[model samples]
Target: MSESLATDTAKPLNGRLAPPRTARVVGLGHRLPDRVVPNGPIAERIGVDADWIVRRTGIRERRYAAPDERTSELATAAARRALQDARLKPADIDLVLVATMTPDELTPNTAPLVAEALGIGAGAYDVGSACTGWLAALSIGASQIETGRADAVLVIGAEILSRVIDPGDKRTAMIFGDGAGAVVLSADGEGSIGPIVLASDGGMGDAIIASHEDRIIHMDGHTTFNKAVKVLVESTQQACERAGVTLDDIDLFVYHQANGRILRSVGEKLELGDERVADYVAETGNTSAASLPLTLSLLREDGRLRPGQRLVLAAVGAGFTWGAGVVEWGLK
Candidate 1:
């Protein structure tokens, strides 16, 4: 009946079901290529004004690819930064998980190629779940550490959507960007890791999806906006409940940076204050699975998140998929 009990009600659901384990984050980093495409230039291409875009989506600028950059380049840069933060060499990694909708090469999978580039050997592969890709990767890494299958896992969210965007259509050209973010997941025995909840409804798969069939971002903006807000709120509540923390108890909350309006809707649902959530949609635009981690990198740079802080990672996109997880930050 009380708010505190209601706040963490979902955590016990996962706790009574799964055995205890230990997990923690050791490092974090991100990278974006050196191209800034502002709304005014995009408006000229799409026959819309900067004012119209701002009024509708609240995006000012987004990064794009250089003539030479690709998805692999972005991911590798972010991964290197993450490894540097951890103060370890590439060979120290036991596993690498790349969360991406756009793979550099369709055959061997992007992970192995990334491993080869970063010199991590054959202990790498790829995971695809559209915008929810990173959260899915985080969940998989958590399980590996909890079960002792891996001592350290490199989780990355990277995208080079500009290459796939239809330059002729301003609708998408204005909405997408290119970037990557990485984090090292491991165990600390202090219960730094907690419950995670993931959900899906394939029927809305078209709402915000890009197909490799034609390799284009096809989105029903209104539908995607509505669904993202609803699902993220549900998962956020579920994650908080499972983590034994109330929304108010969380030090910071991070969500997929699709749009400023969408972020506001989710914030309203959880009664979260502006200080609790960070917004980068204005700068990075929507980098698919890369959005949240990139936002985390920016926040951490300014010294926002710290030990003993509860973090909520939430996202909804493509495959009509959605997920939320609560990670307790306290790594030495």
Candidate 2:
């Protein structure tokens, strides 16, 4: 049969189905605390040299929220910047989703507080997947647009981890920071968002978990490192296949800023050059849910990202949660 005839036969009997609408990130913003804590103090408190902290985590300085700064406050600030970046007001948003594990208060969810502060009269909620929270929320927001549940949604990942980490615990004291990052997603005339893959291994959750007794973050560094590289590589490859693309087609790689060593290892295994991979851990230690989006925002601010570029985002969080997705940058 002729190629044209075969193409014509593939259409539905009634008519050709319209392509599904998709959510595209139209704006991005991030906010880090003004107070920057160098590794000196943290190392001293943990009875280690500053060089030891850097050699292990590749973190030189990290931000700590002020006494009055709460998770909600950081989230609100980031949201406002996102709205401004998209040239839209809070009233224009149809929904708000905050991806966070650290809430300002346990009684009230932080999303609603963020929405109220933004003066958005829309549905608001929270999603917790630890460091993978933002990617999970991105997938959810895209699905909402595809399903006609929302036209424009604001997604924020904010964390005030300073309040949660046990300062005396050397394992975590120098490895966490406080920050918030946000993106505005809305339906577009042309689809920009692509396939997303989310997975979890609850059985291995204990590898990276916070102790309930002491509320301190404990991680089997060696075990978690291996898992992170393997899962991240797998997830990214799956997303690329689902998006009908290849690894070489990707313009940039944005992975969760968990550890510098993990990032380098993943890049090496993927055979990707250093310039193709992003490294933000040196300036901001793992911010949990906020890491991915914060890194993205920084890229945008530095004029590193460009329109029509293909980006692959992957992340691994506590609970063994991990996700990857493809995005075609829609910004001008």
Candidate 3:
């Protein structure tokens, strides 16, 4: 159950601190509760329709947490899978980072529980940056490795929005789901962690927050969307520059899965086109922090992502948080 695993991708790259020849993405995994909430059923239950939900948010279906499933448990499940995929034991992990606003207890920290379950005895903590949680974790994890404080880190985005999603609120119930996705990041002892950019606009936090109603989700979609587009474009540009790459030179884009409209808006502003941005809201709904990393893993499995492609990983979510990262696929 060690944390560091035998990876098919980890290999000796270029200079240690300089431009890394590569940073292999060792493992990837995800977990979703057993309950399936089809669009029609959800719509019927909410007095809405399939077309109605799709037209508004592009969410066709989503998964809900089992009544007994805790947020930490779901995260642990995903971490175990990722460890297995990387052929790593829990003890091998040097750090553990959990991204969630729907934490199990909000104390003792979800990261420690996940590490305890995985057998990793490294620094552990939870990040509560709303939808931007996972992407922020990626940046933080990369930094730890880049600085040598930790060579390997487990970054997970897990959510059980049902804990806060008002089932009666047709606007949100149709758009949120429960799921978790995790990845293993290591330093460039063999590769490098490049230009990563993260930004925040606390002013917009009120646009899509779940506070007043005991922290239940309450969002202003139009306002949130407008800000998302602008932040996404700016983040992408800044990260690309830091990575020493041009915007036009980038290949694929993995963005937070909130809405198809949001994705289209970013692409239009940046001229990235349909091939550039990967949006999964149509299939998975808005999984909050888990959306971007989940899609990245899927792309890897489907062979839709080729090695050496410059990837822009970005997110804009609650707290009005946003960030962009430039990653050249770490491959053999």
Of the pair 1 and 3, which is ahead by lDDT?
Answer: 1
Q: What overall lDDT, based on C-alpha atoms, would model 1 receive against the true structure?
A: 0.81
Compute the lDDT for candidate 2: 0.86
| Candidate 1 runs further than 4 Å off | 1-20, 189-191
Compared with the true structure, all predictions reach lDDT values of 0.81, 0.86, 0.78
Displacement of the residue 96 alpha carbon in candidate 3, Å: 0.4
Rank all candidate structures by their lDDT, best first, as comma-separated numbers.
Answer: 2, 1, 3
| Tens digit of per-residue lDDT, candidate 3, span 1-332 | 11121122434322223422233467678887888787897788899779988888877888888888988898999888887877777877898999998888748889999988777778899998988999888878876765567767899999988778777787688888889999887643222345567878787777887664487898887788888889898998888766656777777889998887888888998987797788777877888988877787778777877656667888988888988877766542
**TM-score of each model, paired residue for residue:** 0.92, 0.93, 0.89
Query: Model 3 Cα displacement at 20 (Å)?
Result: 10
The CA lDDT at 176 in model 2 is 92
Off by over 4 Å in 2: 1-19, 189-191, 211-213
Tens digit of lDDT per residue, candidate 2, span 113-184? 999999998999999899999999998888787667888899999999998887888878899999999999
User: In lDDT terms, how accurate is model 3?
Assistant: 0.78
Model 3 segments more than 4 A misplaced: 1-24, 188-192
